[model samples]
Target chain A: MSRFPAARLAGVAALALLGFLLPRLLGGSAHVYDTLTTIAIFSAMSYGLDIILSDLGEISLAHTAFFATGAYAAAILVVNYGESAWVGLAGAVIAALALALVLGLITLRTREFAFSLVTYAAAVVCMNIAANWDFLGGSDGIVGIPPLALTLGRFSFVAGRPAQFWPVAYLLLLFVLYVVARFRRSRLGQAALMVHMNPRLAAMCGLDANQVRLHVFLVSAPISALAGWLYAFQRAYVGTDLFDTYFLVLMLTGVILAGRRLLLGPLFGTALLLGQKNFASLGAYGDALVLGTVLVGVLCLCPRGLASLWRRRAIPGPEAPSLPGGPVSG
Target chain B: MNVAQQFANGIIIGHAYALVAVGWTLLLGAARLVNFGHGQMYMMGAFVAWWLMSATGLPYAAAVPLAVLVGALLGALMQRLFLRLTLSQDLVNLMIATLGFGQILQGAAGLAFGAKPERLTSPLQAITLGGARVSCSAQDVLLVGATIVVFLGLHWVLRRSRFGAAVRMVAEDPPLAALYGLRVAPVYLAIFAFEGAAVAFAATLVAPRTPILTSIGFEQVVMTFVVVVLGGIGSVGGSYVAGLLLGLYTAFFSALVSPAYTTASVFALLIVVMVVRPGKLAASGGFAR
Candidate 1:
């Protein structure tokens, strides 16, 4: 897919290096490391939804459930079984996939608002279960999660602080970015776009739309789960708050803010949002108000996202900037 | 178990759910617009009335109407913001925009009302009806009465009135309605305003039964979704029946099964219905029916 593979590889390496040095370049305060690590983890989480929203052309509000599933799974595995972070990662993936499969099948026959409503209800039900179920620690949540420890035979590294965690978070973010980029160019990715844009055409070409949706959903769940696995360690806790609408709104805004289908859009969007919250927060309510306003404003004023503004100005004509899969209004 | 008492409780709760979901039913039936913010709007309505009564010493009767007016204005404002998307028939963006609006309302409510839960007391709540077997507060009676009146009035207006015809026409085909000189935009605006007002009215009446908090909207919306969907996605009469059935089911389920998992059980019901009869979800024929 790349015209210049060598140059692209070099570019990726440079970006990774810069990302790793970003905290130190900002004086390497614990706060800086913390903020950047959070941005990375969250952007990775957002990417899971990014594929579904941007490429698959559907809104699954249940992504939050997949996210929460990952965190809860990791917390349960590590906290209850005294397992390693590797096992926690495996548990997170398995649990998230199990959830994604059920949700995918339940919603397979529905579309548009029906799909959205069901997914949303599922997330809410998940949250309620998390809060009320005694086996999951009830409302108190599972705390005292040991710091993330990844050990191999005769070699080990642990992340117990924000600074120490930055590398792991950054690596995860890069891995996610690479995976998303590749997925966009993959056959399933192409099929998803085709199914979204022209279902009849896709069908004529022998594509099973439901199968593609289910496959895409299965692929997306583990990505968010990976982020949650890391998050279980970052906060040293996993609570029902992981299923908050705030996170759902955040993922949607992050995916849409910088324009869909862009590899770096979610990452940049997450950075901008987290940067504001970290440095210039106006308390909880104020921050929420700001986030909500930004989401609404961006959609109302620039439905094509901020990237389109520059394109429109550069092209100057009655012709609208041609979106990749047409206007996402549908 | 006192089956009679639970039955009465179910009737009152059913009416409350129906009242809460009426605006959404109209919006969906007439305009095919989904307001994810409906729950937050309910939260705001309760808080607005509570704030008015507590802060200005206004009577509950006066506070309710004032809050309804505010909700109407908020709805109109939302319509204005969503006008472009609505015009373009961009359902996806419209849905997300409403979600953002809901978040904004929630945050603003938190800032304005504080995080602490507040009670929106009614004078009628102090008055009990019926004897020991199946007693309910006057407020509950009022809620049931108001719900019936609103549903009957809405049913009449939608089925028999000229304005109802125009709304149904718009819902059926916006372009054709506009070609026939229906003034489509005003119909949408009016539908949205009614949605806001109706939900606020529901909030004013039903919110007194529980403590009001910004966070309460989350659970409230889930119930609303159940009613709307089970009612066949926009059926005014169907929603009323669905709400009643759900209320009875909830009452008995909480009593016999587990109160903690009621929402989960209700959601499971929705999933089952979706799987068994997916076509009902896509059908919009309930507007006129």
Candidate 2:
């Protein structure tokens, strides 16, 4: 594992630098900046789900609720309470954590389809509340949100345009990528993988599977919320549309597209998805069809994901024995 | 609000809920498969029937059967796509795949039908029972009758038919059934096709009461979930009773409380059931008593 520490670090740094300059390299147009920023923010959003789906092996459909909570928290705090971006970020995390705690508790005993169904029902209920409640602006949604503004004493920076916001979005994505990478190596992360892969063995090792799930879920929610925190500023509005199944499907597709447990999978998957939507455009419905097809196709044809195709070709030996039954069993 | 009217309304809506959920009940009971796309399939069913009527001037009777056929075909296609995952019992991927299938259906319906809300008209909608006191459209009567008939027929088929025995065997243990020389794949295909057909039939019947949209399925399916879970997760008789009870609860809640929070309240009911009896959810019990 420690064989090429210096070289791997160098490669990661180079790649990060290139990702930062990708928009500029693509012509530095407003369109380019907007697309890249959207990609970054959405990628960050998908990472939250990636942790649970990849590491914890449960699909919490209510991640959309967490994402919405983050956006709504940011919007309500800044637009209504007159707070700064830092405060908004704090609010987003707290709100998402509280939601995650409740959801985690409710779903603690359930697994597989029951967990998914409960979480899905939770998201739907949240949407109903958002659409009906006046505090969240009812059906109209809270609009006219000011652009990203951060002030530290006398120093101030405001990002009102796509190009100006690119750095913050990029930095958020990088931070999320770092956290996810570290989480994959952390003790809790190992515990989560153990619980997911073999609850009986994990129990024999004196681990509480439910505790591991709750903690992983807690860790995962805020990551998505942070993305939603940035998303509120990026869109300049927070609406009920945030709760659309589109985001849920996108997150699932992103996590599953390139392959699960791969650090760059969601980021690459999101980039490809948003790239198609932003540049090689299909109208909304057409794009939806494409997204749905990709998700179904990837899971059905190659559960290991698109990356496995090349990996198989690159190393032709006795084929790896198939997984007996798991989410990403290839 | 008129109490009798609410009671009548509840009964009719209960039947609608049961009818809508019957397919899912069978799917879960027979195959232990969960379709996140069931709601979208409901949406498609309504839209197909609506289109058939409007486009071809077909009678509601003819259009509905045709829509059910289309739905059965769609179900078969989904089963074909998901056959590998289903066989492996890799339920996690199967669930997500169904969600994708739902998305594809929604997008296709939106493109084909456009965003404008359309109504699936029933001639019987004009007729009413118990004039002015607790009246319901004749269509509501049909809904109730259809629910009873469907339930009775389903009960008989599962209890008395060879196909029912095959489904139960597959549901109990797919590999074991295969080893016993049962063609597990055909059983799965048939179950999925039945799910599609039943949901479509429910859609054609129930959708006339409300404005139909590609998006209605999003919330519409929630009640079905509540019914399925509360009714014992694929028990046909239990689902019927649960649907009726939920309908009554929803009717009175909307009447006595807030209409907007009905879905929220229904979900709260589901959560309570899960917390109280989590074991019921994980177990896919027998097809009948």
DockQ of 2: 0.73
lDDT for B164 (candidate 2)? 87
> All candidates' TM-scores?
0.98, 0.98
Candidates' C-alpha lDDT: 0.90, 0.91
TM-score for chain B of all predictions: 0.98, 0.98
After the best TM-score superposition of candidate 2, give how far the Cα of residue B170 lies from its true spot, in angstroms. Answer: 0.9
* Candidate 2 stretches greater than 4 Å from native: A325-330
The regions of model 1 sitting more than 4 angstroms off are: A316-326
User: What is candidate 1's lDDT per residue for B1-289, written digit by digit as tens?
Assistant: 9999999999999999999999999888777888899999999999999999999999999999999999898888888899877876788888889999999999999899999989999999999989989899999999999999999999999889999999899889988999999898899999899989999999999999989988888778989988999998889999999999999989999999999999999999898887788877984677756
Residue-level lDDT of model 1, residues A115-145, one tens digit each, is 8988999999999999999778789999999
